[model samples]
Target chain A: MKMHNFNSGPSILPQEVLNQAAEAVLNFNNIGLSLLEIGHRTSWFQDVLDESRSLIKELMQLGEEHEALYLHGGATTQFMQVPMNLLDDGETAAYCDNGIWGSKAIKEAKLFGNVNVVASSKDKNHTYINKGFEIPATSKYLHYTTNNTVEGTQWHALPETNVPLVADMSSDIFSRNMPFAKHSLIYAGAQKNMGAAGVTLVVVKKDVLGKIKRAIPPIMDYRIHIENGSLLNTPPVFAVYVSLLTLRWIKKEGGLAEMEKRAKERAEYLYNALDSLPLFVPTVNKEDRSFMNAVFVMQRPELEQPFLDECKKNGMVGVKGHRSVGGLRVSMYNAMPMDSVKAFVELMTEFNNKNL
Target chain B: MKMHNFNSGPSILPQEVLNQAAEAVLNFNNIGLSLLEIGHRTSWFQDVLDESRSLIKELMQLGEEHEALYLHGGATTQFMQVPMNLLDDGETAAYCDNGIWGSKAIKEAKLFGNVNVVASSKDKNHTYINKGFEIPATSKYLHYTTNNTVEGTQWHALPETNVPLVADMSSDIFSRNMPFAKHSLIYAGAQKNMGAAGVTLVVVKKDVLGKIKRAIPPIMDYRIHIENGSLLNTPPVFAVYVSLLTLRWIKKEGGLAEMEKRAKERAEYLYNALDSLPLFVPTVNKEDRSFMNAVFVMQRPELEQPFLDECKKNGMVGVKGHRSVGGLRVSMYNAMPMDSVKAFVELMTEFNNKNL
Candidate 1:
């Protein structure tokens, strides 16, 4: 079966990236060495680290005002590290709790200092992002999750804040074009739209670091990796290599503007299909639907299994929703082809006509 | 040209494992989906996680007395986490400063509590492991790095401490059959003897957890990972899979007993050859020479580059000494075939004859 992968992270990557990564693992750059065996300090792997960082800067249009770093640990680790570096003891940081990721960031920040939840969508079960929410001028920084993968909501606009802005763009980074200048720090786990799961991409305005009162471990310190060129320790070489390849793919496909256009189109196609169908209900507030992940529920609960079964039989994988909110979630990341979306819509239409 | 990888870490992995990993990245398990794109929450990946964790336990001979955790971050993170979870706010922990890793561990530990250096090889420039060292009886735990990758020294025996023993066995793990039960906590970064960088293997005694005064982050708490079965967050799935394959490879090739026997033979073969050669001088105390990484300097300083050139032309990689100590280091890890050692010895002999 020619399967269409819609799994939310560790999700679909460019086929070209996969091919290149496979070739490298077998014999990297005709060196007759497996990528797994290459020394991290060697020039070949160093090129990978350099180019990956460079590409991120280019793709995001980050200027001299920002510096990029590749660090181990994932987005979850960043939840604490962000505060540990940026906020001081007893200082306050503002967070907008729109979903699970936002709440997690808020929780971790509280461990370092006081956190004021500037706004929350918890009252509405996170079905809608509460825009026009206020950010306190007293806070050291304002934090938010740009996209909620689990809850299927994404911020359509940047929150206005006088304080330094920090965003965890883990699930939707590079899928759209956003104003990069508004944020002091932007971090994303590479597993979703980037490449693999081992490395996290952190872009910070260099001047924003070194203010915290706590002794941050070297691995946790963004400044250490930035100064050492992300080679302070043995990095996850293969993951960064694949990420570079994916970044190259994104560049070749006309950068983030094209990616955003394609993503919006795909999501619109799926949403249109969902609205036309009687059997399914798109779950999130329509205005806040995520272009990255589209969540829906079956109107007739008993029909859910058969619909999933038919989709699987027709070569769909990872469409099942997260356990916390179950139904269906088609994660249309950047690499998910338009044809795959069309096929999914076709399946939905056929199922609706036959069973409605 | 055929390259022989001997880069202490991110080092040699089995060709078969590499092939399998490469294939899965393209299309996993004939599922017509790339492993890079699959949902970690799915049954497919969960199976990999389960078997990998199980294999580590089986290989380490760890039963219910200890639980193995596939942790994020690296061994460096554990340097703080071990004390944070194990020691109270004011309690002191004993540490042996064998080399760089030991020093780093002690530095991170100090962030959480007091650290008492029971013994140190620093007085001798870290070229020898201090024997007959005593652990502080009043300390909460005793910590040591079993093998110094940089200085090329290994502990022949662990300290007899009544307190819980914590070993950073990052470099020498799986190279020998050590007393696994002697330590309550053993943490290793996977890049050295295991497979790749990114994932860390932590074996913690179940009873020793839940005693710290500080509030550890969810990712920092070993107990949370243990309870969640190491799936508290999306792990470095590919790295863990590679480590699992390496563990299986070790088991199939006659387990740790056979591995130890081969490691000893390879180390002895190289050391004996170095002893007979007049051009090179071994650095560490002969009694404390590491079986994993063998460090040596040129008898005449000018001959260093020539010797390195000769080795490189003969297909040796990663023989360059660490910058802290300028000399050659031949890391004879578990996966290094005996023929490679034989080849290295031959090169040494030829170079010695030319220099003399």
Candidate 2:
């Protein structure tokens, strides 16, 4: 049975990437040594680290001013590190709480400094993207989760901010064309669209660092990591290499433009099916719906389990929504084929006919 | 040509573990999805995480009072996290400076609280472990590196301390039987003897946490991670899985008792050969010489490159020493085979005969 993996994170990667990674594990580049055994400082693995960073810059179309780093501890670690490095004890940072991830990010930032939640859609159950948030001129930075993975909202437009922009683009990064240059710091966990689960991709402009007064630990400091070329300590070697393979695939398959086209195509197909079916209810404001993850529920909530069971019988994985949101979530990341989305919609159509 | 890998950390893993890891990457346990694609929250991965943690506790002979965690950011991250979670502001903690890793750990600990350098081998170029250093009763913990990777030193016996013992056992954990219950906390990066690079293994006594007065970030908080079962966020899924497989192998091969026997046999075989050869001189105090990494230098430094080149030509990898200490280093971790060490010693004997 061909399993359609909609896992959301540690999610579906390109088939070729999986094959290459597996081959490398056994014998890396015909070096007679497994990739698992290779030293990170050696040229064999250095090439991997170097190419991964370079590819991120190339894919984002960013310039030399922005540096890319592959760090461990994921985006969750970044929640505290971002504030620890950027926000001082007395200084304030603007934050937008649109969903679970956004709220969590805001909560972490508050520990290091004053966090001004300029916008929040929590009152409405985070179904929409809040706009026209006022950013204080004295704000150190405007922090936002560009794409809400749980609530399924994505910021299509760059926020108007004079201060440095720190965006957690964990879910929607590289899935679409964006004004990436406008942001001072852009971070994404690799599990979704990028690669695997162990590494986080951080793109930071050099000038934004060294502004804080508090002593930030070297491991948590962005300047130290960038200065060391993300080799301050032993990094997640295999994860970064898999990410490199993923980035290479992204480039070979026509870059973000093609990715964006495919993302829109898949999301539109699934969303159209969801909207057309009376048995399924697509949540979240339509305008702010995520291109990566589509959240929907059945008209009869009891039918949700039956539909998910139907999905499981037909080899659909991770169709069940996150625990916080008890509905179905069909994640259409960059690697998700349009054919898979079509099959899922067809399943939905059949389920809807029987339930209705 | 079969290359003998001896890179210090990110060293060799059991061949069967590598094969299994590669297989899992393609299709995990005959599931329709790649191991890389499976969600961590799913039962498929929960078993991996649970078994890995349980195996660590069982191997360490730890009871229910202790908890095992698989975290990201490597052992380097633990350098800061240990103090952040255990040492409070204005308090003091004891640290032993054995070598590079120990020095780094001391440096990070200072940021959190006053560090009392109970002992240091820096005066002697970190060639031997320091002894008889008084640890303060007021100290939060007595931190030391159980086995120094660089400069080739290992503490054969635990230091006498009333303070809770915190150990950075990155190089030698699971390699030898120790007073496992005596230590309050132990951490090792998985790259060395465990599995791959990415996840770190941390074993902590539950009672030691919540003693610090400082506001620890939730991400850096051990209690939070323990409470969440190391699933506070997305862990390095594949890395943890590999570690699990490696742990399973360790148990199947008679656990730490068998590992220690193999380690001693390989080390003694190589050390005996080095002693017999007049051309190559082993450094470090004989009493404190590490079983994991054997550091040596050529009698004539000029012949070092030629010897290295010769070894390279004959399929030897990572024979060059760390750049900080300019000499040759042969690492024999838990997974290192006696046959490979014997081959290396034979090569050394041949080189000595040709030169001297």
| Per-model TM-score on C-alpha atoms | 0.99, 0.99
- The candidate 2 chain B region of ten consecutive residues with least summed lDDT is B211-220
Tens digits of per-residue lDDT for model 1, A236-291: 88888889998999999999999999999999999999988989999899999999
> Which residue pairs overlap in candidate 1's backbone?
none
Query: Per model, how many backbone clashes are there?
Result: 0, 0
The candidate maximizing DockQ is 2
In the predicted model 2, the residue pairs found to clash are: none
Tens digits of per-residue lDDT for model 2 on B1-356?
87787889789999999999999999999997899998899999998888889999889899988989998888999999999888888999999999999999999999989999999999999999988888889888999999989899999999998899999999998898999888889998988988899999889998999986788778888999999999999999989999999899999999999999999999999999999999999988999999999999999999999999988998888899998998999999988888889889999999999999
| Model 1 lDDT per residue over B108-164, tens place | 888888999998999987998887777768898999999999999999977877998
Q: What's the TM-score of chain B for every model shown?
A: 0.98, 0.99
Q: Candidate 2, which segments miss by more than 4 Å at Cα? A: none
